[model samples]
Target: MLDRRKILTIGGVAGAASVMPLARLAHGDSTENGVRNATSHHHHGGKVTTRSVAANAAPPLDPFSVPMPVPQVLRPSYRTSKLDQYVLDIQPANVEIFPGFKTAALTYGGTFVGPTILATEGRAIQIKYRNRLKEDANVHLHGGHNPASSDGHPMDVIPAGGSKVYTYPNRQPGATLWYHDHVHHLEAEHVFRGLHGFYLLKGYDEARLNLPSGEYDVPIMLRYGKFDEDGQILFSPYDDVSTRTTFLVNGRPQPYFKVAARRYRFRLLNASNHGDFKVNLGGREMVQIASDGGLLPAPVSRKEVLITPGERAEVVVDFSDVPVGSSVVLESEWGPVMRFDVDRRGFDTGGPPAVLRPNPTLPKPTVEREIRMQLSDDQQVFWINGKPFDPDRVDVRIKRGTTEVWRIYNDDSDWGIDHNFHLHMVRFRVLDRDGAPPWPGESGLKDTVSVPPGTSVRVQATFGEHLGRFVYHCHMMEHSGPFQMMAQMEIVQ
Candidate 1:
C-alpha cells in the first residue's frame, strides 16, 4: 500500500543547489533539491506549506528533494480598457504529485493547484470558464463581492461541455482571496480532485507602498492529503481529517523553497477540506500584514499562525537577518514539511509597514441572528439551524446597508470536530469568541471564522448593497455539501 511514507520524503541533508531554467523558475522553479538560483528579483522559493500529523511515518524518498511549486498566474487572453478577460478549460489531467508517479486529477488549465488569477482592485475581471470535465461544474470566486449571477450560487452550474462567464468588479481592497468549485453536493469531491486556485485582488494604489510587489509577493496554497497505492488522491471526506498524515506543499510532499535574503510577503491559503494548519518558520518571528479581507490596519507579530480551512493569512518575513547559506525549516503540527534556504543576496526595498490598508466602516448593527451548527444524530447530515441547505429557502433576510451581528455556535460536542463558518458576498470583523474578546491573532476582517466545538463566535458586518441571495455555512466542504450544512440569505433593499 502507498502509505504516507511512500509519497513524502521529509527533511534533507544541507547543501547548496544549482540554478534551473528561467522559465521553470518563473513558474515555481522546482529545482530538485535546495533552492535554485533565479536570474532576476525572483527567488527559487514559492509560496507554500503543508499539513499532516503522522510523526512515525518513514519515507521512501529524501526530504526536500523537489522544489516548491508556485502556481503560475494565468495571463489574460485579451485585455480591454474596462476589464481583463481570460479563459479556463476545466478538464481532467494526470498530475505528477509524487516522484515517478502520476496522480489522476482535474485541473484548470492542466495543473493540480489550478492556475492563479491576479486582478487589479477596481478593475473588472471576466473569466470564461469552459467545463470539459465529465460532470457539471461551476466557478465560485470565494470571498468575491460579485453580482448574484456570477457568485457561483450552489444551484447555478455549467453542464459538461458548457461554459459561462463570471465577472468580478474587484472594487474592494487588496486581499488574499481564492476561487474553487462550488457545485452543490460534489464540491468536496471536485475540490479534493483539484478544482481550486488563488485569485489575488491587488490594490491599484499599493504601488506607492512598494510592499514586496512582483515575484516577492507569493501565494502559497497549503493542504493535507491521503493517497492510494497508485499515488492517486483518496477521496474521503467522512474520514477523520487527522487520518490524512501526508503534508503536501502545493501538491508536492516535503519540498524545498529557496528564498532571497530580503524580506518577502507570503500569502498563505489553507485550501484543505477539513484540516486546519498551524505553520511557523522554526520560531522566527513573522509579521502578519493581511487576512481574508485584505491588509490589516496594523501588523500583528506572532510566533505561529493557525489557519482553518478556507481562511487566509498574509505574513512578511525578513530573511536578511538570517545567515545567507543557512536554511530554516517550516515546521507544522506534524513537524517540518518544507525548507526555506537563503540562496542569494537579495535587495531589500520594503520595510515593516507602519499602517497597511484601512478597514471599511460598516453601519451600526440593526439585526442580530444566532446560528447553530450541528450534525444530525446519525452524523449522516450536517445542518445549520437544524435544517439542511435549501436554495429556495431564505434562512436570513437582512436589509441592505444595515449591519448585523451573528453569534455562530458549534453544537457538536459528541462529534467534537473543528468547524468553520464562511459567508459569501461580504466580509466582517470577528468581535468575540465564546463571549470573550477575540484573540490578537484574529484581528483582520475575514469571511471565514473558525468555531471549535462548544464555542461561539460573534461577528459583525454590513450587508452588501447588491440585492440578491447568497449563502453562509460551515466551510467544511463535506459538511456544507452532501451533508447540507449551508443556508441561504437575501440582501433586501
Candidate 2:
C-alpha cells in the first residue's frame, strides 16, 4: 500500500467516457446511465454535472528531440521447473512524459509504459498481482488462451489492498499477447491512466526462425493524448476525441531511437482508446512476420501496416544497407511519430528461412451466430442486440468441441462510430470482411478484427479447449463502458 502522503494523486472525473460519437452531445455529461436500455426522453444537458474544463492543446514538441526509453524485460521474482513467478504492483506514479512536466498516472510495476513480461511457449506461468489503487485492478492477457478463472473477468477484481495469483496454462502457441486492466465500467479511465504491457511467448515457431533477438528486438506502444498548459494529462470522457491530436509512442511525443544498421524486429501494439494507426517507414518496405496471433505462415511485404485499437503487428525492418548516421522517420496521418537513427555498423543475420511454418487450418464450422454492436437513439446506453451488458445472463452457450463462424456487425455505424470485435480465450481465423477477403496482412490468426461503420466481419473460431464463461465485445473502451456493448458466451460439455 502507498503511504498516505507519499504519492501525489491527481483527481479526475469519476465515471466519464472517452469517445462520444456525437461530439456535440458532450456538453451534457452526468453520472446517470439513463433508464439503461429504456426508450428516450431524459433530456438533461451537459450543464447538469459538468467537471472542470481544460485546454485542447497540441503541445509544442520537437520531433526526435528525446531518445525513446526502452522498457526493460522484467526478471521474475523466482522460478521453478514448471512455471515462472512474477509480481505486478498496480499503483500510482508521477512520470515525466512531456519535456518539463510530470504526469501523475496509475501504472503497473511502476512503469509509465508497462514493461514486457517474457514467458516460454507451452509452459505454465503464475503472476501475483497486487492492487494498490483506490479501486479494483485485474490483468487481462490479451491474445492469450487463458482459462476462464484467470481470464481477467471484469468483476474478478483484485480490490484495493488485496492480492491474487493468476495461473495461466500457457497451452497455446507463441504469440505477442498483452496485459491491461479490464475493470467493468472503468476500463477506459484505468487504461487511459496507463495500465498496459507486452507479454510475448517464445520457443515455438518463432524460435526456429531465429528472428532478430536481444537489442534488435523492440516492443513499442502507440496512442494519442490531450494535455493541459502545465503538462498535466487531461481526460474529458465526454468529448469525442476532437481535442486529442497529440500522438505519442511509449508515452513520449515524437521521440527518436538509436537502432543498429541491421535487421530489427519491432512488435507494435495499438494501446489507444479509439485511434487507428497507419504505420509507414518513410516509403521503405518492410515484411510482416507476425500478426495478433504471432508468426505468419510466410512473410508479406507491405509499404504500410494498418493496425486498430487492441491489435498487434510485428514487422521486421532491415537497415543493413542504409548509410550510417542516416535516419528514417516513422509516420502516421498526424505526421512524425518516431525516428529510427541508424548510426552503427552491424551485420545483418537474416532471420528464418524464407518460410517459417505452415498456416494451420481450423475445423469446419458446426455452429453460426450473429451479434450487433449498437447504441440507443439517446446515446446514453450501448448494447448488443438491444440489451446492455448483464453479467448474470448467459447470452450464448456453445458445446466444448465445436467451431462457429460469427457474423459481427457495427450496427450503429449510422452515427459514424467505428467499432471492432474481440473474443476472449481463443484466437480465431478471419473468413472475410463484408463478404470479401480480408487484407493480406490480416490473413493470420487473430483475436480482434475491425468492423467498419455499416459493415460486417466473418470469423471462424473453435472452443475445443477451455470451458467456462468468456466475453465478446467492442474493444473500444468507450463503447464497452458507457454504451455497454458486450455479451457473454459459456462453453459447456
TM-score of each: 0.87, 0.88
Best by lDDT: 1
The model with the greatest TM-score is 2
Please give, for residues 1-493, the per-residue lDDT of candidate 1 as tens digits: 2222211110000011101111112222222222121222222244323322322121345678878989988999999888899999999999987788888898888999989898888899999999999899998888898998999998899999999999899988888889999999989899988899999988765776658878888888887666765677776554444335466778787788899998899999988776667789878999988889988888899889988789999988889877889898876644566888898989876676677776766667988999999866544577889888998799988888888999999886444445789999999999899878886657778999888777899999987767888899888787788678899998888
Model-by-model lDDT, in order?
A: 0.76, 0.75
TM-score of 1: 0.87
List the pairs of residues colliding in candidate 2. 17-237, 27-46, 28-45, 28-46, 382-483
Segments in model 2 whose C-alpha atoms lie over 4 Å from true places: 1-55
Considering summed lDDT, which 10 consecutive residues are worst modelled in model 1? 10-19
Query: Model 2: per-residue lDDT, tens digit, 1-493?
Result: 3221111010011112222222223333321111001111111232333334332454466668878887767888988899899888999989877777788888998887887888888788898999999998888999888888899988788999999998888887777889899989888788888888889888566656878988888888987666676667776445435345566788776689998888999999888877677789988988888889877778888899878789999899998888999999887643567889999998866555778556677788988998888765555666787788988999999999799999998885445456788899988888888889988778778998887768898998888688899888888776676557788999999
